[model samples]
Target: MAIGGNPVFRGKNFRSAVATAPPVPQAPYGQNPYGQYGQPAGQSGYGQNPYGQNPYGQPSAQPQGQQMTPEQLDQMYKAPSAGPVETGRMTYDDVIMKTLACLGLVVLGAGVTLFVSPAASLGLMVLGAIGGLILALVNSFKREPSPALILAYAALEGLFLGGLTRIIDAFAPGAGFQAVLGTVVVAGVTLALYKSGKVRATPGLAKFFLIAIVGYLAFSLVNLGLVLFGVVDSPWGMRGIEIMGIPLGVIVGLFAVVLAAIALIFDFNSIEEGVRAGAPRRFAWTAAFGLTVTLVWLYTEILRLIAIFNSND
Candidate 1:
């Protein structure tokens, strides 16, 4: 019942139910005919009455009206049925719908920032980046998923992405579009591989992913520090350093892209497990949130990589 690898899915909310036999109901005192409370053997007050009438003084066992016909019973049986939510189970449709909702909000937020003035968009982007990061961390560590917070994170990330795209595209026109196309391609390919069983979130691969993520985070933090301290004149800090006549950013970006793809695999695996385990329908939001985080990361990395290539040209 344990969910591992994905921080967003590591809570009891996603655990599977344990099956056990139902306890047998015991009879009340003096109700048992077999000598309970001095009751006589083979003597009982109960009797089978089809009309639900008491054997004690009361109305006759037969009802006044005639019973419904088989046609009526058939009509009742043909009525529209309740859905999965009504039955209290998570379903693929639920996950897909919620995921689409989150993505839609992201697109809406991005569209707003995309058309705004540069100065205003920059300010919003800064606010969005900081806010998104906080919310993302909050949602990840939360025991239960919050729909409001997850949507908020998506909107903030969109704002950040839109502004970043605007700024980067100014320096290198069409780079943003290329990045979008690249993100789509990567996601599609990753999904294909996952569905085809060519890629999987095996334990060893998951461990490797964790190590790589930690190293990448450390490097990114150090690079950010160098850039802020004016130790690296390049906008990308050490990533702008050339190796074999190619910017180091390309290498790192490609590596990061692979990691992001693998992260998608993990997300897919978690979702599949959740569905198979009959996790609560509410956890569909968690699955959506996880996919959003990985996708945003994937898009940003592709955007940066494309931007660097354009800058070099």
Candidate 2:
């Protein structure tokens, strides 16, 4: 899994960190693999003898200890091995818990916005948009994952989302709920497909994603400029422009939704790769952050798509 789709996953040496567990040296006949003469683990240490003589050439006494039976040795050898959790590596559970924590903070922050006045909500939205972007960039470029930064980004994004939802819903009743439902359905399907191995992040698809995302961003920037300069009177700026009686925003928004779905697939791939590669447990925060970012973007696109589609009616 080459980390290329999600920029946040980029530069993180996941594959390079794939730690292969060294094969355990088999114990002789009645001896234990852990240690000898009832010595604790690591007592012999690597390349050092626990009995007779030490690696330092010191004459150490070999204690005469009772040895284990064949049954005991067989049972010990048959025991299940340590997993990611025991090895202090990333796991699906780690990612799920951390992602939930980040999302909980987002919900908490959004709930706070709901209690504020409309004026305050607008202010919070602006604050969140700017502050979240700064934190996102900072966190993405960091060599290691920072839980604090990722959580903060989620909270700020929540503020923005809450305000945006309120504004959109006010204009188009039930649009918010519909958009949320749409996002959930799309995300659920994407995840299921990815888990089933039907959807994978390929280099070719990633390249196409990159190009499409860049094009979308460029168009969005141009549209924002037009709207700001009063060159486009429609509420959606260039997006509101109609072609054959159909709004351009409707078509573009759908394309953006597809892009967001592909991004989610990439995010899932990143998480799966990280866990398989035995990444550090803390990198679960990275996985959580990437998922949150993609999900947030997915929700926003769905919301806009709904809003644009409603405008056509």
Candidate 3:
């Protein structure tokens, strides 16, 4: 099975929890495992009477002391297999619920920003951006998922996103809504493709994604430095420069959107693997956090892309 590219899924517990079934015991070749449907081994049974009673299911008259009747055994065989809840394993529903809870907190935090003054909002946004990064790193490296920390990260991210949207939308009206719509569309399409088996997280693709993400991060840090030092007058720094009549930000923003989309795919793959492998139910929070991170990345990239395009006009 493909271990996903998401960092959270690489924990030791996640890896160790997915164990293969043990091999079944085999009887000696060319010997009858069952004989005459319940006759004693020394009489008509072909198999030796080492264990006394037959371990394999042999249809026989129900003895008085037997716990299960033949009809009950038939019902047991016909019953459905245990679900994730019954088996105490992670499931898609668990991921969905946890994801929703995290996102709800994010929305609540964002909504709080609306009532605050611009100055206060800006300060809160900075606090959220710094705090969120810390929590995200802490959660990513932890051996087990921490729901409180994960939700805290989400809430902080919401504040940052809310302030960012307010600032950008002030200049480019309706850009925030457009970015949200674009993110939803992109995510929805990627999920559809994944469900159809047309898209997958392969090892080769994961390697490429890792390299690309590293390069993108390097470029972003360089750009941030340039902007902070006033080496570039434009708000986007080097990204505002034109290349062949197109703003660099537009190009880079699109590339970033693609990367975020791919990250979402990796998140989906990881969650599926965790659930299928019967990971602990609490790990659902980890999956939720991974997904929220990807979605936030996707939303930010889309927002930036829209802002760049609007600025060019």
Candidate 4:
């Protein structure tokens, strides 16, 4: 596991299973053909030849009527099909299904908030934001993931997002739709870049990302404080300020979008490592959670950026 990067992926679950598991010793060539307890060849507990004789008093090896062809011999040695816990480990199907489940719940919760009255929506959004924060923290620190908790987090986030989008849409009609499209574009581009090997979560880059996230969080907290204290009158607080005739948010938003995209790379790396390490199927929920967090952040940043631009115009 890569430490100090994203809280959702900072643990042993991301480590290689081969690295952690005890190694199996290989049998020496031409010795112990049965490969059990290093027993000598042609020996059994009952003094019978284990390889050539059956326990039912039947001769296991008889004179071959016809020699096997090369293709037949190759077929006989083919590997067995993989089970859920096999060396092939987690497949793309597992991650995709789990992620879709989480996203579906998010859409369900959002629907509830979107149709509700304004006052009720505001209350739900507040509750959802606080609940989502707590669940996100709990899920991040958990050693093993709980599907229920992860689903709950997604629902709460959906509620918060729904209300926020409604509020933003009231001011700027169709802004929410635009934001969704923008999120899709950004995520698609990031994923394509990742698959193309143009971006990766190298150690040096990961460390830099952690540092940048800390700085960004600190800035956000300060900006929120200023807004709450009435020090900044604009909707976006400090981000609404202009530098050289350009809104600060345009600059800050682009930086935040890039950071969110980098975070996606980290998520992808963690998922790839987890699958390669033969992590349990349940851990797919963790992968989904990490991706959801990144996607939500990306969408909100894009939504606010667009809103700021619309307001300025």
lDDT of each: 0.79, 0.81, 0.81, 0.78
Residue-level lDDT of model 4, residues 132-227, one tens digit each, is: 999998887787778899999999999998888888899899999999999989989989998999987888888889889999899999999999
Number of backbone collisions per candidate: 0, 0, 0, 0
> Model 3: per-residue lDDT, tens digit, 146-181?
899999999999999988888998989998899889
lDDT tens string, model 1, 241-298?
9999999999999999999898888888888876665667788898999889888999
When sorted by lDDT, best at the front, the candidate numbers are: 2, 3, 1, 4
TM-score of candidate 2 versus the correct structure, residues matched by position: 0.85
Tell me the TM-score of model 4.
0.81
Per-model TM against the reference = 0.78, 0.85, 0.84, 0.81
What residue runs in model 3 are displaced by over 4 Å at the alpha carbon? 16-68
Instruction: State which candidate, 1 or 4, has the greater TM-score.
Output: 4
What digit string (tens of lDDT, one per residue) describes model 2 on residues 1-313?
Answer: 6565678877543334434423335567956666643345756322235355655677744333434465665565567667778878888999999999988887777777889999999999899899999998888888778888999999999998888888888878898788778988998999999889998899999999999999999999999999999998997999998999989998899999999899989888878877766788888898899889888888899899888887778
Question: Which residue pairs overlap in candidate 3's backbone?
Answer: none
| Superior candidate under TM-score, 1 versus 2 | 2
Best by TM-score: 2
- Root mean square deviation (Cα) for candidate 3: 5.9
